[model samples]
Target chain A: SQKIEQNSEALNIQEGKTATLTCNYTNYSPAYLQWYRQDPGRGPVFLLLIRENEKEKRKERLKVTFDTTLKQSLFHITASQPADSATYLCAAMNNAGNMLTFGGGTRLMVKP
Target chain B: NAGVTQTPKFRILKIGQSMTLQCAQDMNHNYMYWYRQDPGMGLKLIYYSVGAGITDKGEVPNGYNVSRSTTEDFPLRLELAAPSQTSVYFCASSYSTGAKTQYFGPGTRLLVL
Candidate 1:
């Protein structure tokens, strides 16, 4: 079975700094990888998505890099703020797109 | 748009009891999915429907059932609930385009004893 791993340890950074989260998968060559933001007591909200063919994608202050070579992806939030604190999840979808398998997720905390 | 909406935000059920978690979306999307999230674990897809009558099982569909009778509604049913069924459930919908983004509901919290 395919396995996805994200840093289980929370990432803590000072406000206005860049916060980076890592997602690595094993034995899975996904068609597309996506990132989501989740808060306590709520479902995840889609943030950004990058295909295996694409190297990187950015939206506003958020950026995502897909390095299929290493089976890893990096999610970066620039100028992070307290409000940006949340759990970040990475999901990998295969060619059939039947379902998205999600990683455990990394919690990001921006301190002021 | 109302995005996705799930009813009965919280519920408590006894062993062998059954209940349905209602999910609806006003986006007229063609793809709907049900997922469960347990502590320390990310979301796990339970079931998904491509359209109104086409349903498929996901990784954790063993204890759950789903029906998509309309484009806007996808409900998840739990028959004879068990302790392992206790988890937060979310319903999401997306456009027909493969790999399109999904809109998710607030999720329903279930507790079984």
Candidate 2:
């Protein structure tokens, strides 16, 4: 079975600082990895995605790095704000394009 | 685009009862999926459909059933609901592209006693 693990249960950071979340997977090599932001009582919204061949992808203040060899993906948010406080999820799809498997997710709390 | 929509934002059911969670999308996507998220746990895939009339079981599909009769609607049915079945259910859909970025509904919270 495939297993995905996030760095921690929660991370607290001050405003204007950088927040980094880790995702590690085992048992499979995924073609693409994605990140999502989820707030309370709402569905997750897509954030950034990085392919296996791509080293890094950036979107505004959000960035994602994929290391296929290490089976790890790092999600970073620069100049974090209180509004960025939400649960961050990591997901991956295999080469066969099968169902996407999700990690437990790391809750990010940005302090003002 | 209305994106994805789910019916009955919250529901409470007794043991042995049955109900259907309705899900629809106006995006006319080809891929639809059903997932359940328990507290402090990741979302577990229940069922998925590639297109109309093509469905497959996912990681957790023991007590759930789904049908994709149209490109816009995918309904998940729960039979003989149990305490273990109580969780927040989410429906998502995506286009047939390589990215496969799924759009999720607000979600339907189910409680079984």
The Cα error of candidate 1 at residue B91, in Å, is 0.6
lDDT of 1 by residue, B79-113 (tens): 99999999999999889886767789999999999
Q: Model 1 segments beyond 4 Å from truth?
A: none
RMSD of each: 1.1, 0.9
Please estimate how well model 1 matches the true structure, expressed as its whole-model Cα lDDT: 0.92
Compose the digit string of candidate 1's lDDT tens values, residues A1-112: 8888999999999999999999999886988889999999998999999988999999999999999899999999999999999999998875577778889999999999
Candidate closest to the true structure, highest DockQ? 2
Q: How well is candidate 2 docked (DockQ)?
A: 0.87
Q: What is the C-alpha lDDT of each candidate?
A: 0.92, 0.93
Candidate 2: lDDT of A4? Answer: 82
DockQ of each two-chain model: 0.82, 0.87
